[model samples]
Target: MTVAVFDHEGPWTEEEYLALGETSQRVELFDGSLHVTPAPTPRHQRISRKLGNILETAAESVGLELLEAVNVRLRPGRVPVPDLVVTAPVDLDDPYIEAADVRLVCEIISPGNAATDNVLKMHYYAAAGIEWYLLVEQTTGTLRLYQKRGRHYVEHQAVKRGGVLNLSAPVRATIHPEDLVP
Candidate 1:
């Protein structure tokens, strides 16, 4: 008889993942294994860049700071690099990004990451207690907003192209989907 063994309790350190370096590779260390994703397509980059800029601008108006694709080590071996993250002001020597300090997290969904972003990532973000998460789908040109509710996030709204996405209170900006994609 054969029994399966899994590294369920992983206190995997950061150094292991960093060694792989940047090759347009998107990888998350889960249970001591590397879950790697391919480089995002051009359309993905456009939406991500636009969303980052828009969020940064809006956050600035409210006296907040935003970080782009910064590593937020949610747990020991579960680190997923979000497209953009908004956090409170950090000291120059702040070590790691944690879920507690994050105000918002946005992910630009690509054809390859639709299932992971919409399903897998959604659960992870909710489990980490991220306040807000926005998903921008490039193919559909749609923006979906989710706000933390109890232990999960309920879809706040789905904004289509040309529609305005109103920023949550304190951060005021109405962004049109077309403005983000093109």
Candidate 2:
């Protein structure tokens, strides 16, 4: 009942989530709840940087942009700072990226966040109709690429260490799984 006071359908409103602003920790809003994740390990960051470089380079030719840990508003009350996002050209002045403009969202799964990346986020991104979803599992050095299929995601490809991930949508890129490690 009190949720109506926020004037939003969800328990948390976009304004309330925005009020959180930037924080030291990784805070994602989902269904009126907050999921706070501790900072990623240095190793995690390194992988994200390397993977981002590959995607960014390829995305440029297609007029797409790769952003690291940028706020992506999946819906009115849902915002997740993905590890990397491939989006169509957006206004630099905007504080957040809209789901409609996003082509792909990448997440580097670390020790504490496997479930969130593998299940929760996949659901969110797929439901948002993001064209692609890339998941890099830190421990296994594996990469899984998913494509949206009718409001859900289906595995498009999977590669392990010493293997390559090639995708044409979002951007044409070849990624070597080994490069994602320290």
Candidate 3:
């Protein structure tokens, strides 16, 4: 049986949020609120898996770890799950990862929430002190890498389908946008 998420009135606490347990949707906590994301399309999943494999290689080469869709507690009361996260290996059993340990966060832009990924998450990740942010644009088969500058992100690289994306920070990764789709 499914439980009603909004039965109580005030903002959700970490305890109350944790009580929700696992669900079919992607749920995140942002500023004492619950944000639910629909399960991604198969095409979106394919792209995420391919890009994850590519990121895995890079992360492993540098002795870091790559995790997919894990909760990252950015601050005292904010958490947002990114599509991919890279960091120094830590205990996987922990409730959530603290942002300071995170080296990078990546989001594969989704159709309904492109702006959220491009704007909201970019700012959120930066403010959380994550050093790198990578955005994948599936519709155009392109990728953009941004490096945190103070409280915001500055574009470090933009690669289209035919071009090669070479990243030197947070890890050294070589990605070809065309390979991300299939």
Q: Compute each candidate's TM-score over C-alphas.
A: 0.85, 0.91, 0.94
In angstroms, the error of model 3 at 115 is: 1.7
- Give the whole-model CA lDDT for all candidates, comma-separated: 0.77, 0.87, 0.88
lDDT of 1 by residue, 40-59 (tens): 77778887787778778889
Query: Candidate 2: lDDT of 145?
Result: 94
Clash totals for all models, in order?
0, 0, 0
RMSD of 2: 4.6
For model 1, the superposed segments whose C-alpha errors exceed 4 Å read 1-13, 19-23, 91-95
* lDDT accuracy of residue 129 in candidate 2: 80
Candidate 3: minimum summed lDDT over ten consecutive residues — where?
Answer: 3-12
The digit string of per-residue lDDT tens for model 2 on 11-64 reads: 666678787778788878897887777789999999999998899999998888
Tell me the TM-score of model 2. 0.91
Q: Which stretches of candidate 2 lie over 4 Å from their true place?
A: 1-11
Output the lDDT of residue 28, model 2. 81
Reference-based lDDT, residue 39, model 1: 74
